[model samples]
Target: MKPFYIDYPQEKIAEHQHAYRCLHCKIPTTIIFGLLENHAKDCAYRIHQGRWTQLEASLKPIQKHFDEPHIDEVD
Candidate 1:
């Protein structure tokens, strides 16, 4: 899982020449700090992504266990 959420949609803040924010949550990128939880509780992007993250985590497959091949097995 990504430790930060920097890929959310963003748009220029109205009347602010150098400010931007999340399109769905309207929270400033600076405030969000690339963390999904920083978004508003009812934010569309946050809700969608939060569910996806949880689902992915729950459905993640376990790694397969295996042993290394012996040196004598080399062809």
Candidate 2:
């Protein structure tokens, strides 16, 4: 998966409930699907700091890989 950013609360980071853990402190962080302006409230990883916006493209490629052909093969 591409590296998407999330602005999680510092307190939540302490609990570590979220799956994505902070790289620096190893604490749980939030996941932001898209880009945004301004730092989120109480977030340890603020986009304003310099964290590059990242995201995984559409899942179409993965789905197509697993999808089976509908038409019958020639005999």
Best by TM-score: 1
Clashing pairs in 1: none
Which portions of model 2 show Cα errors greater than 4 Å? 1-18, 21-30, 34-39, 47-75
TM per prediction: 0.75, 0.19
RMSD of each: 3.4, 9.6
The residue-by-residue lDDT of candidate 1 on 1-75, one tens digit each, is: 689988889999988989999998899999999998899999998998889999999999989978978788965
lDDT scores for all predictions?
A: 0.91, 0.42
lDDT of predicted model 2: 0.42
Q: Name the lDDT value of residue 27 in candidate 2.
A: 42
**What lDDT score goes with residue 45 in model 2?**
57
Candidate 2 lDDT over residue span 1-75, tens digit each? 334434443343444454554443444433333323233444445533344333224433554455665578563
